[model samples]
Target: MPTPTPSPDELLVFTGSYTPDTGGNGAGLAAVRFAPKTGSLTDEPRVSPVPVSGASFLAAHPSLDVIYSTNESDTGAVSAVVRQDEEVLSPLGAPVSSGGANPCHLTVHPDGHWLLTANYGSDTMPGSVAVHRLDTDGRICELTDVAVHEGTGPVAGRQESSHAHQVLVTPDGRFVLATDLGADAVFTYRLDTGTGRLQRIAVNRTRPGSGPRHLAFAPDGAYAWSADELSSTLTCHRYDPDTGTLAEVSRVPATTVPDVANQPGGIVASPCGRFVWVTNRGADTVAAFRVTGTSLQPIGEVPSGGIWPRGLALVAGHLLVANQHSGTLAVLRVLPTGALSRPAPAAHVPSVVCTLAL
Candidate 1:
C-alpha cells in the first residue's frame, strides 16, 4: 500500500537554540510550521517554551513522541520532552548530566532503548560519547556508560584533545559512529543493549588535521561523508555494515566562496542519494555536490541567506537552514541536479543552531 501524503502543516519542526545564559540570544525551545509546497513557514511561535540552557541540537525518538536535545554548555546536559501534538510539549523528566562538557549532538538508537550523545569536552576534559537508557514512557534516564577518546591533531588550540562533535548510529543499526573534531578521526562503537554500554570497535582517521565534525550516510547506505570542520574539506568513506568500518576513499573542498576562510558546518545527503548539501560558516554559503557512486562532483554554490549558517536539514524538497549569527531561519529550494535556490527567511529566530523535522 502506498503511504499517505502529509498535509502542509502536518510536519512539526523544532528549533534547538542557545539562550542568553550561553552567550547566545535564544529564548528557549521554539516551534514553527513549515509549508513544503512554497518552501516557507506558515507561522512562528514558542510551541515548546521550556528553557533548556544551550539547547543547541535536537533529535527525535524513533518510535515515540519524545524529543531529545543536547544542552551545549561548559557543564553539558541532555533532556527529554513529550511532544503533545504541534503546540504543546511537556517535560518528560529532569535534565541529566551528559558525563562531559559541551555536548553538541545526539541520536536515538534504532532499537529505541538507548540515547547516545557526543560530548565536546572542555579545556581540562577530553571528549567522549555517553550512553543513556530510556524508559518505556519515553523519559530520559540516567547515564549508563561513556567512552572517552584520547589523542590530538596538529592544530594547536583546536586539536589539543579529543572532541567528539557528533554521534550517529549506522543505517544497519549495528555500529555507532562518532566524528571527533579534535582527534581528526571517526570512532566506531558497538552498543550492548542489555548492559547499556558502548564498546570501541574501530577508529577511521581522516586527513591528519581535518577535524572531522559530522557524518552523513548516503541514501543507499553504501557510502558516508564527513564535514571536515578545521581543514575545510569533505571526506568520503566506504561504509561496511557487516564489519562496521568506514574506509576513507576521497576528499573534496567544502567551500566554493572565493578567498574567504571556510569552516563547513552542516552536511547532509539528499533523500534521493544523488546530491549532498553543506553549509560554509565563514563563507555563509551552501555548497552543492553531485554524488556519482564513490566520488562527488562540485556543482555550485548559493548564499545561505543569513550569517553563520550553522546547520541545515533537507525536508519536503527544501533545505532548512538555521542561521545562528543572523538569528534567522532560511529556506532554500533543493533542485533536481543537487543545487539550491536563493536563501530566504522563513522566520527570524535568535541563536538557532539546528532544525529537526518531525
Candidate 2:
C-alpha cells in the first residue's frame, strides 16, 4: 500500500445532540491527536463542548481562531465559539437566535467581522436569514439585520413555504449565497462589511423540484456548485465576482446509486478544486465528480461504510465522514484518481457524528 500523507497533530469533532434538556452541553464534541501518515490515533481521545441545540452545520473562520455552528431548532439560534486550544473550545456567550425558526446553516465573513444564518421553518410562519457582527474576541454582537423570503415550491406537501438551509459567503467577502430548500432557489446578497448589511442581489432557480440544500465554491472561485436534496441533482453556476451574480451553466445527476430514496446531504469541493463530493445518506455512499469549467461529470460512488453520512470534512489530507446513524467517524484516503477507500479502523465515537477537523 502507498503511504499516506502526514496527519496533523490533532483532530476535533462536534456532534449535534448537546443539550441540557438531553442531559448534556458541548460535552459531546471530541478531540484526538492523530498521526495520519501512520494511520494511528491517540490512545485516549479528548472530548470538548460545542454549545448549540443541533450542531447541524459548522464553519471555521478563514483565520482559524473561531468556529460557528447553527443551533438547528424549531426556535433556532447560532453560536459563535472560540477555539482556545488543541482540545478546548468554549462558547463566547449565549447563542443568538436566528430570529425566525429552525435555523440550519451558517457562514462567517471572509473579514471575520460578520456571520450569517439560514433559518428553515414552515410557511405559516416563514423563514429568514439573520446577520450578526463578530467582535475581536470571537463573541457575536450587533444583531444588525434579517431578510425574510417568500414563495413556495412545486412539491405541495414538502414545499408550502420557505426553508432556507444554508448561507455561504464568497471567498473574497463580496457576496453571500443563501440556499432555500422550499423555494428551490439560491439567493445572492451583496454584503457591506462595514455596516454588516445584506442587500438582495439575485435569485436563481434550480430545477423545479430540486430543493436546493447546500453549496460550495470551487477553489479558483470560477464556479459554484449547489446540491439539490429533493431532486438528487447537482447544478453548476458560473459566478460573476464583480457583480455577485450566479448563472446556471449545467445540471447533472448527483449520484449513481440505484436507490431513489437516498437524500443528498452535504456538498463540498476539494481544497484544490479538482474534485467535488456529495454525500448520499440513504444510499450510504459518497459520490465523486470531476470538474471542467462549469460542468461536472460523475466519477464514481464509494461506500461511506456507515449509516446516514451527514457531513464531510478534510483534515491533514484525509477525507473524514461523520456517520450520523452509525455514530462513528469514517476516515478515507483520497487517491490521486479521485477515489476513496474503506478506512482502516481508527478513531470511533458513539451516539451521533457531526464534524471532524484539526
Candidate 3:
C-alpha cells in the first residue's frame, strides 16, 4: 500500500536520543520528514531542542550541509550541526571532548577531512577511537587522535572491557572500521589523513560470544556485515578493499527466535547492495538478508514496528526502524524481492535510538 502522500523526494531525518540527562526520553535532537512516496515518517515529528547531551548517533556531510553527533554521556561529547532551514538544526561549535567514554559511534571521512569517534569505554575504560579534525566549515577542529582499545571477551557483564560499539567508514574511503563491543573485535584502521591518526590496520576476530555491534559495508565494496551484539549473531565478511581486511565468511541467526533474549540491534546495507537488514534487540525482530553469492540468505524475521529495535536506516526504498524500547518510528517496506514489509508506525519517538537520512 503506497501513497500516503508527500514526496518531492522529501527526505530529511536526523533523530538520535537518550537525552533526559541520559535516563532517556529524548527531547534533544529530532527532526523527521522522510516520505519517499510515503514510506512514512512525517505526521510531524521534531522534538529537537538542540542541546546535545546524549545525542546517541548521527553523521552526514559527504559534501557539507553538515550534521554530526554522538554526545553519549558519562562524559563524552561531539557535535557539529547546521541545516537551519527546512526545520532547524543549528549548533556548529561547542561540543568537542569525546576522547573517551560512551561516545557510541560516528563517522565522516569521505574526504570531509576526518571526524570519527566511537568511544564507548566505561566500566573502567578500554575502547576508544576519537580523532576529529574538520574545518572547511564543518566545525570541530581539535581532538586529533586517541585510538585506545585493549581487549577482553567471553561476555560476563557484557565483555568487561574494550566496548567501542561502532565507527565504520569504508565504502572505498580506504578503511576505518571499529566495532568492538568489548572485543569480539573488528578493528581495521588507517586514516592518518595528515595527522588525525588512526593507523591500526586489522584485527577482525569474531565468534567467542561475538559482541561486535554494527559494521555494514556492502555497496559493492566486496562484502562485510556484522551486528553480532553479544551473540545474537550475523557475521559474513570477506571484504578486503585493497587490504583493510575482514574475512570471516558466514554465521547467521540474527534472531530467528529460539531461546529468545536476542540483541543485534541494528545493521543495514541496501542501496541495492542486494539486501541486509537486522535489528533484533531482544528479538523484537527485523531480520532479512540475502547477499547470496558470498553467503547469507536468511530473509525471514519480521515485526519491529516497535520495541527495542535500536536503529537501522536505509531510506528511499524504505526501512527506517528506530524502535528503542517501543518508542516507535518504524517504516519497513523494501520488498521488490529484498523483503521486509510489515512495520507500520512512523512517529512517536520518545527515546528513539538513532536514524540519519538527510
Which candidate has the highest lDDT of all?
A: 1
Off by over 4 Å in 1: 1-10, 46-48
**lDDT, candidate 1, 1-358, per-residue tens:** 0112236445667888899999898966777778787777744463747788898899988788888989888888999988776567887888999999999999998888999999999999999999999999778788899999997999998999999999998988889999999998899899999999998998987888899989899977889999999999988999988888888899899986779888999999988888888999999998999997688899999988889898899888899888899988889998877788897665888889998887
Residue-by-residue lDDT tens digits, candidate 3, 1-358: 0112233768767788887798887775777787677676773754345767888888887877778888887688888888755565688878888888889889888889888989888887788989889999789888888989888898799887888888877888787888888888888998878988888987888778788888887877788888888778788888888888888877878877888888887888887788788888877889888888777888787988878888888887888888877677888888888888897666887888988876
Cα deviation in Å at residue 150, candidate 2? 1.3
lDDT, residue 77, model 1: 93
**Compared with the true structure, what per-residue lDDT tens digits does model 2 show for residues 108-190?**
77777788888988546677789998887768887788888876888878788988888888877678888899888888898
TM-score winner among the candidates?
1
> Candidate 3: deviation at residue 37, Å?
5.0
- Per-residue error (Å), model 2, residue 228: 0.8
Residue 100's lDDT in candidate 2: 78
Candidate no. 3 TM-score: 0.34
Q: Which residue pairs in candidate 2 have backbone atoms (N, alpha carbon, C) closer than 3 angstroms, thus clashing?
A: 26-49, 26-50
Order of candidate numbers by TM-score, starting with the best = 1, 2, 3
